[model samples]
Target chain A: QTASPAVAKPSRLGLCASCHGETGMAVMPGAPNLAGQRLDYLRQALKDYRDGRRDAPVMRAAIGPIGAAELDALARWYSAQAPAAASAP
Target chain B: QTASPAVAKPSRLGLCASCHGETGMAVMPGAPNLAGQRLDYLRQALKDYRDGRRDAPVMRAAIGPIGAAELDALARWYSAQAPAAASAP
Candidate 1:
């Protein structure tokens, strides 16, 4: 599925960019860098949000309206991005 | 803050564990493995969901009620966990 501007606009993932950065890197404290993250894992996360198996009011709301096709596009987009320099000390 | 049973229970991140596997690995298709992921990155993702920047409807809902403290705990939990075998083929 292709990510349309209306569908995949940064607004959808804008809050994500705050900590995940525009490219999925952790730009803030306590956030995990998502650049170069595995596609399988990203997809599962989207599913978890949809199923309500995971608990996070904010996450559930963000992913509430998205469909599987869009989720796939998001996973692919973030997974394909390069990871930021390892901040692990 | 410590992860309480009601607070930091797997239910909150349960859906995440599915593709992320119990250990944050990508056990399913289109998911990204989060094991061994940077703690900073995870925190950012939670924030994104809370802020509505990310486009996944499911994720926003999942992270809706989570506070920063809990988000930190979740990030630490996943980041500290070991990553499963790389499926990056």
Candidate 2:
């Protein structure tokens, strides 16, 4: 069997993968795809969700306990992922 | 009557304001608050929706006919808006 790719998942990604897939393609309707997004934008979004600057109960609950450094790491991971192709309509 | 602040609306913002408010605060559930999001990120999102890189039927239909320069203008307008305070939970 061929060896699988060794992509290390960011530890702080916690529950984000449930909706935003491991590589940042959104798995559910209404969740924005996060792959290949700007790092700073992702950082800001995480911060916003955690700090109550953006209001989304599910997001707040998921990211609330995460710290600034951890948030940055999560942002970096999602931003670095390859953007998936458009889903079949 | 008191003169309201002279915020110029971007012409290309067409149907976006119906959901993503004129100032980018989302008006409906499931629509993300876009106020103060990164200009480049917003521009990229608009392009992705228009070009089918990101698949959302509503976003695709809304932005498909818009041009690049117009999309950029809409991004600039939304990114410049003040981020709204988080809604009461």
Best by lDDT: 2
| Fnat for the candidates in order | 0.47, 0.00
TM-score of chain B of each: 0.72, 0.84
For A1-89, candidate 1 gives per-residue lDDT tens digits of: 12223324444577667656667656766655566677666777778778875556766766776787778877766676654333461
CAPRI category for model 2: incorrect
lDDT of 2 at B6: 39
Q: Compared with the true structure, what per-residue lDDT tens digits does model 2 show for residues B1-89? A: 11113335777665888977777666665466565555555776787778776565677777767887788778777756654333210
Interface Cα RMSD in Å, per prediction:
5.8, 13.6
TM-score per prediction, in order, is 0.48, 0.49
Candidate 1 C-alpha lDDT tens digits along B3-42: 2233234445776666556666566666555665776567
- Shift in Å, residue A71, candidate 1: 1.0
Across A1-89, the per-residue lDDT of candidate 2 in tens digits comes to: 11113335678665887877777666665466566555655777777777776555678778867877778778777766654333211
